[model samples]
Target: MQIQDLPYSDPGVPDARSGPHLLWWLWRNQLGGQLRSLAWGLLHFVSVSALPFCVGLAIQAVVEESGTDLALTGALMLLCGIGIAVGDTFLHRAAVTNWITAAARVQQLLARKAAHLGSALTRRVAAGEVVAVSTGDVEKIGWFVEALSRFTAAAVTVVVACVGLLVYQPALGVVVAVGLPVVALAALPLLPRATRRADLQREKAGRATELASDTVAGLRVLRGIGGEDLFLDRYRRASQEVRHAAVRSARMWSLISAIQVLLPGLLLIAVVWHGIHLARHGRITVGELVTVYSAVMILSYPLRHFEEIAMAYSFSRPSAKRAARVLSLERPTDAGGSREAGVPRGDLYDPATGLLAAEGLLTAVVCGDPDAAGRLAERLGGHPAEPGVSVLLGGVPLDDLPLDSARTAVLVQDKDPVLLSGTLRELLDVPASGAVSAEDALAAAQCEDVLEALVQGSLEAADPMDARITERGRSLSGGQRQRLALARSLVTDPGVLVLDEPTSAVDSHTEARIADGLRRLRTGRTTVVFTSSPLLLDRADRVALVHEGEVLAVGVHRELVATDPRYRAVVTRETEEDPAPAGADRNLTGQGALLGASDKLAEIEESA
Candidate 1:
């Protein structure tokens, strides 16, 4: 594919079996570009090598005092020079094209994998490693791929030059031919040591990168806890380790480079020494000696390709391995049934926990363990952690449904939902079935305070929807960000909305208003909220107490509090309490309103 056609329209499936295999796959895919680059490289090197031969011929013509031969040789020299200039320029162009296109293809493949796996990608691979692969690692892989053609052409040039030298002068040719292979093979023993050092350096660098990413991500928390210096010290140590490893790796490579230069220099001296001996013996003439010397010098340039190709492979092998590991990750597939056949939509049930969220009701689940709650929430949304486990919707296995269909059918908003950086309108811009408008969703989410906050900050022109939100809504207050996420979820209006701690960051008053608004907005829809807030629990049509791993009690909030001591302790955070009187459920429903009115009056009295 052309470089411009990049980010391939499909980014076709990758062969992620192994690192070497991935590199081979990439090479095969870009054979056209590689061949073009190889052809241009051959032309460039051949023309460069021919320059020495032309000079030798000119010297012979001049020595013989043949005017016609001198003219023809001069003309040949000019043509070789022109060929060198043109070939070198285009060779560079083709090689660069191959490099960029190969990198682009790998980048596209990575991006596609990221999108496919979503949050699961980070779970399988470190965020920093993913970043490294897509950026620096991509370039390294492309470098190896692009260098392949040039290396091939260089090898070919060396072989052809050796053959030409043998034909031109047998004595000097034998010396060069024998010495060239020795020079090339001499460095092979050092490569394994260098490669091992390179791998060590890469490992250290990846850890350092991961440490930096994690530290940055938790900078706010570290500052809050007064642990910034501790983290800084840790990162400093990691950075030092990375630097030490890099220096060590560099030392090995430097030794290899030294060997590369030293061995070639020794070969060059041997060839020159032999050529002089042959000349002294009258076995070769001055023109032939000059030609043999020039050919050996030209051969040195191609010999360096061996070292470069080795270094490239050493660096790129690990990078390709990391990239392949990420690309090999596959989304969880259901072995139960065909998703294309479609499944019914109704009540959401997790057989693992025996938690049933009846259709068209706002079911609240109270769990003592937050982690269990989160896992249960994910399970209810068809993303069970265990294989062969499934969440059923309308008596049909949710996992059996197509990914898009499952997502559309059940929307799960985790406790810590992410808000992408964009304008408020852009943030709310999501694929919806049009059941609710932006204004309605905002109102349902009780986001008037969020809008007012944006307006008061003058973050946008009169319309709060146009206000820009910083990354993950860092500029917004915790409560405001939570409400904005709730509004965004409400807009989708999925059949079953699973919310985990939707109002954990909000005040009781705001949480109360949100609970009421949510119940009203999702009156006829299935909404499963995983929370322990009394305000939200009071409003739930049916409340289930999840103790250990199974549903222990299923009833209204008042009934569960009165009957189950474990449920009461989880919800109220107290072990001892008076049992509610008869008709307490009826009174509690009224108390929800009375509490709201009392809070408002207190606010007004304080203001007055």
Candidate 2:
């Protein structure tokens, strides 16, 4: 379908197997607008063609008859000039409208895809690639869309000009007609090379953008570890590689530009030579010869558009492909309905792992492998697993339920929580409509200080909304961000809350408060917190030790340690100095102070 026929301004269809078909679709859909632009552009170019004839006529009129009625010819020339100016204005306006609208439509489609994919987007695609596609690639695609109409108009103008030349003087016309095609088609030969260079440049640019993004994100950690120089060097290397690729692309474009310039000039010279030969033979007047020369010169304007369209298409095809890739990502689906008899009041189960989290009971999972815990958390939250794992909430398979229903029922608080920039109150506000007061949620998450700080954050301003939070809450400490994220989740009051390390950063006092608050706030709710913290585990009614991808033991925190040596070693950090095993669910547990205390106790006992 043409762009005009698209449901939205930009049709971001992902099935790129039919790129030409889609381009045709866009043409058909926006036919009216395209036609309007074409008509205007044609009128403008035809006006240019008329100018040469008018100049020749005016020159002949001046030489042959001093008192001739030049008024009529002069009036025609003035009118054509006015028409060209007016048509050019409207043509550009229509083209720009099409460009901006089409780009916006694509953006809208991408945004919809992002919303549907949710967290899955990051899992499926690189963050940097998405960033590049949205910003730079989109503009490239828009550039092509805007050029299409004008390009068509330019081609039409060239054809009309060539035909006019043929009718005016056959000998000069043949040269005009033949020479124009050579100039317009000159850029076609270089397209393949140009496109290859553009692709290389885009690829390298994407890599560089990714590296820069990664470096920026990890800048704090790099600085902490005194690896800033190393990361900077890596980024510099990536930047240089991108620069090299860009230079290659520029070189190809420069060659194309040279051809565009040379071919048009050569065509004009050949047409002028033929026109002069015709004039010498008394076949055409000297004024007609001048007109032929003027037409050939005028033809250059539209001929340039031919090269531009080629360049635009070469750049846009890949950009559209990139955009399509993002749009093609499928939203996760559940095969069957999970609507059971009860209101989901039972322990969670994962058939893939043969593990059961008992209902109304706090469960602690100690995994020898941290990745195993993260996978378990993903499963427990009804999130799509990396295959071979299925999570069931209240005997209902999570994947079976609609995504919205599943998410509403189960909340997964990630280890690295994202805090959107907003006021403290705004940040605490969540999906559930007024189920829990902000104050209550804050108290439950033990975030009294957080609120106090926020209130104090904008003490001078009359409104709390005036408080400024930097992007990603960079202004806040990691622990504060974590607590705030927890508070937001608590406010949601989901039936099942799967936390991946809820208190890994806070001091013991705050950790204990948070634990108490969670227990009190999440009363009667199925809450599963993935933590190796003694404080959180002690609060759990039962604990499960995961070993070899299985629940080796399931019991209270104390009982699991008493019975399972591996569980004791894993939780107490007796096996390794590090509290978490290699690749353990990120120490999402904010209760590092409790774990630190546990470590000190173990040291004292070992010394004894």
Candidate 3:
């Protein structure tokens, strides 16, 4: 494929069986580009080699006192020079095209894999490793792929030149033919040592990259805990290790380079010495001697390619292996199941947790363990703890339906929702069934303050929706970001919505308002919320108390508090208080009093 036709229409399924296999697959896919580069390279190297032959012929013509022969030989030299210039120009163009196209193809495959795997990808691989593969690893793979054609052409040119020399003069030809192979093969012993060092360098670099990424991601937390210097020192040590490994790898490569130059230089001296001896014995002509010397000199250029190709393979092998590992990840699927299509319209049920969120009702789950809560939330949305743990919707197994169908049928908003970098309008521009508008969702999520904060520094006429949000909404307060994420999720208005602690960051007052708004907005939809806040639990049509990995009670919030000690303790974090006096307002005491106190503290904090 050419550079212009890049970003393959379909970046077809990759052959991710092994590193070498993946490399070969890439090469096979871009055979057209490779052949074009190879053809141009062949033309260029052959023309360059022919220049010496032309000069040798011209010297012979001049020595024989043949004017016509001299004119013809001079014309041939000029033609060879033109050929060399034209061939070299296009060879470079083709090789660059191959490199760019190969890299683009690999990048497309990686991007496709990322989309297919979604959040599960980060769980399976390090974020920094993914970054390295997409950026640095891709370029190394492309470099090796692009270098292949040139290496092939160089090898061919060396062979053809050796054959021509043997035909022109056997005495000097035998010396060159024997010495060229030795020059090419002499560096083989050093390659394994260099390759091992390169692998070590790559490993150290990956760790350093991952550490830097993690450190940057948690910079705010590190500063809060006065541990920024600790992480910085750790990164510094990691960087030093990377630098030391790189130096060792470079040293090995430098030795190989030195051998490459030294052995070829020795071969050149040997050929010249042998040629001079043949000339003294009258076994070779001056023209033959000049031609042999020029050919050997020309042969040195191609011989260097052996070292280059070896180095390229050494570096790219590990890169390809990493890329293959990432690409090999497949979405977990159920065995012996035929996937059904279309959005599922039904009650959400998780068999593993025995949690049933009835059709068109808000069901809140209070789990004692946050980790278990998160996993249950995933299961409720069809991403189970293990394959075949069925999460069914509308009497259909969620895993037995197509992924796209299951996703459209249920939308899960994690406790720590990510607000991607973009304008407010773009951030909320999710795929929706058009049952809810952005303004309506924003209002329902109590995001007026967030909208105001986003538009604070903008021009007066600028729309709040047009205001920009920083990466992951880092610029916004925790509550504002959470409200914004809630608004984004509400905009989708899926058949079933699974929210894990959607209001955990907000004040009790805001949470109370959000809980009321969420119930009113999702009145006739299946909504499963994993939370312990009494404000949200009180609003749910039914509340499920999850303890020790299973639901122990399912009832109204007040009934569960009175009867289930486990549920009451988990939610209130206290022993059950005596039942409130008859006809007392529920919001005046106990959990309600604490929630009210929290609201008052939040108001005071805001005022301060």
Candidate closest to the true structure, highest lDDT: 3
Q: List, residue by residue over 50-139, the lDDT tens digit for candidate 1.
A: 877887888888889999988998998889888878878988988898889888989999998886566667867999999989999999
Give RMSD (Å) of candidate 3 vs. truth.
Answer: 3.5
Q: In candidate 2, what are the lDDT values of residues 136-188, reduced to their tens digit?
A: 87777778877888888888888888888788878788887777777777778
Better of 1 and 2 by TM-score: 1
Residue-level error in angstroms, candidate 1, position 135: 1.7
Q: How close is every model to the real structure, measured as TM-score?
A: 0.92, 0.86, 0.94
Show model 3 residue runs off by greater than 4 Å. Answer: 334-337, 459-461, 575-589, 594-608
**Local distance difference test values of all predictions, in order:** 0.85, 0.75, 0.87
The lDDT, on a scale of 0 to 1, for candidate 2 is 0.75
Off by over 4 Å in 2: 1-33, 57-70, 331-347, 357-362, 385-390, 394-397, 452-466, 576-608
Supply candidate 2's per-residue lDDT for 56.
80
